[model samples]
Target: MKVLRNLIAIGLVFLVILSSGCSIKSTNENVPSSSNLTVKMLDVGQGDAFLIKTSQQVILLDTGDIDARDLLVNKLKAEGITKIDKLIITHPHADHLGGAMGVLMNFDVKSVYDNGQITTTSTYRKYIKKVTDSKIPYKQLLAGEHLEFGDGIKFIVYSPTKRMIDTEEDLNNNSIVGKLKYGDFSILFTGDSESAIEKELLNKYKDELKSTILKSPHHGSKTSSNNAYLKAISPECVLISVGAGNDYKHPHETTLNKYKKLNFKIYRTDFDGTVTITSDGHGYNVLKEKVQ
Candidate 1:
């Protein structure tokens, strides 16, 4: 009996150590919403930015590119967003986090969340300094975690697992991938994560990955949106945040063909100034600035 107890104690300790790497944390306070949830894929030339508005909070997903901070700020101001409740920077890539300083400089940010990746770029340095100097509450997001999105909507984070972030040098794959869940309506936000991470998510989440919509991975780049992974998510609609006449030629043809084959409704910020989706928990309606 003594031997069995010793072995059980050791196994329990091992399990605790294994699970401590990444955790699923939830806040005790939840402010349930009485209105619809809104997500806008703002058009920021040559980069990406998404604004999510719950009834009680406003969340900025990405900050576009370094050169396009004005456009990002102007667009937000045009939308009457004076303050941001949460700023979630997916990765430290130039295009994704370049305008982070602009956001920090222009708005009242309540808190910040990121994947805990680091880069030596000046833009990153400036952005981090601003966050630190401002004394904003900052937290690192990892797989298996949850963030409250206000009014019962929550973000179920699924990527940049501590193991992967430590082992994988690719910042794109380390991008934070999360699914915004609001009742029956949900959309997966892929922060430029590539095929390998998508496959990992497939194996981990499986059927749970199915979402009503997918914020097309990697801005519709061919390097992402793996066929098997797409089949697993089975998104009815795909939203791509790419810039017009981009040198990188994003929203590649191969990805479009795949979406077509699957008959998923497609919307792109390049064609549509800003694509917004409003969900009332049970259903959703998409509204865009213009038609292509």
Candidate 2:
């Protein structure tokens, strides 16, 4: 009788271990998978545009200057992107949304994301008209909405809150701020947002402002990239989009000095041509195209 009892106890222990192993395997299967999200900061002179390619989607943040349309099209073609999953205008600034009309005409876009806030530029008006004619789905993204691309890639809109939108400030202060996350990596894209906007976002999302990369706000203009904001973001690398010999003297010396003091690696499109960052869902690589 004793031998029989011991055999039953051993069998029960074995069953419990087997069930625990199965539970662990099931948990692993439910975890989200890693994704390869590639971000390309195209050199379109003194303008801003960023192409984000994920495992399941392709997104264009802005389109640079109107004249840069051809360059943008060629680059998209080279990437074999015949369609764009989403196009975010960020704002109605001429330099940011000017080439968007060309892109809308060239590609089959699933949707267009913008604040729908008008600006004084004719280019902005024309782009808005094109979107209206296309009848494509349009949505005004606001802060707190989290956008998810395939795999584990996600973007959180963190700026242009209701109060900021109502404030009669310069459009730059109202520019949309987007934070992208792919696994352990995060990137903050500030679209021409000035010191005031930056301060607001910093205060709102102080804990989440930590990012691995930063798209230097307003092309690294002195008016943006405030010291407090910079200290909060603490990006490991900074990318500045500006044109060589720009009349405005973009990427101001003061801003450059701030970045230098922080010891963050910097990549300037005007000097490096095109900058590309690719991630394996764990680590990222920064590649620069030599300016010809």
Candidate 3:
């Protein structure tokens, strides 16, 4: 009887050890991997530039103002980036595409996407000349178009529809409005887009316009972020890219108050310098580099 009892006790101990080992192995397997999506809102001062990095590709959105050419190039180099897999110029405005020439000269750009809007400014002409000379594949960003950068990471264009009317209002309205989606995470980029376009997008996309983050339209200008538009696409976080002491008084007080009233978390390049948000397709973390 005693020998039988000892055998039973030993078996129970072995079972417990095996169960623990299995539990540990399962826990190790369940651990999450590192974040694969990183979006950096560069501080180009009164201009716009964003660097998006996925597991397999790098994308650049806009290219700061002319004065920021060297800084923008150096910033790209510091990240050890020698090539841009996809470059999207949201509009033809100087603050948005002024550094296009500098970027083309420095990096090997695989493809370029633009809203197909034309401007007669010197900077716009120079940009076109450089793009033509580079022989890079260029395409117009159209509504309903989809671009996939990696597994489960994609961009959906939602503005500048086929029937766009080329009027003065079309310049800002034609600004490429798109959303980057990865799993449950989504970010909306509205390049200088304002009320007219915002209203149209709200009508077209409705609930589909929801996002986790919003790059505030027109640098948080009062002309954008209308009350009706804000409520339609309620983003958890808002990023404003503007320069300190800018002439336009970007991120107007009323705009800030509206976001504040909505209880949305806001980060600004003017205040935070460079703002970066990284996500693992599930959730994201925001980090800022303070300007000295």
For candidate 2, what is the TM-score? 0.86
The clash numbers for all candidates, in the given order, read: 2, 0, 0
Can you rank all candidates by TM-score, best first?
Answer: 1, 3, 2
Error of model 1, residue 36, in angstroms = 1.7
lDDT per model vs. reference: 0.88, 0.84, 0.87
lDDT leader: 1
Model 1 Cα lDDT, one tens digit per residue, 159-250: 88898778888999999999999998899999899998998899999988999899998888999999999999998889998888888889
Cα miss at 288, model 2 (Å)?
A: 0.7
Q: Candidate 1, which segments miss by more than 4 Å at Cα?
A: 1-35
- Cα-lDDT of candidate 2: 0.84
Count backbone clashes in candidate 2. 0
Give lDDT tens digits, candidate 2, residues 1-292: 9999999999999999986654211101112343388898998898998999987999999899888888888888888989999999888887888789889989999899886576667887787778888898888888888788887888899988766666655778778898999877889999999988887888889889999899999999999998889999998899999989898899999999999999888899887888888776667777777633
Clashing residue pairs for model 3:
none
Residue-level lDDT of model 3, residues 1-292, one tens digit each, is 9999999999999999986654211101112367899899998899999999998999999999999989899999998999999999998888989888899999999999998877789998888778878888889888999889896799999988767735444677788999999998889999999998888898899888889889999999999998887887798889999989999999899999999999778888888878878888877877767632
* Stronger candidate by lDDT (2 vs 3): 3
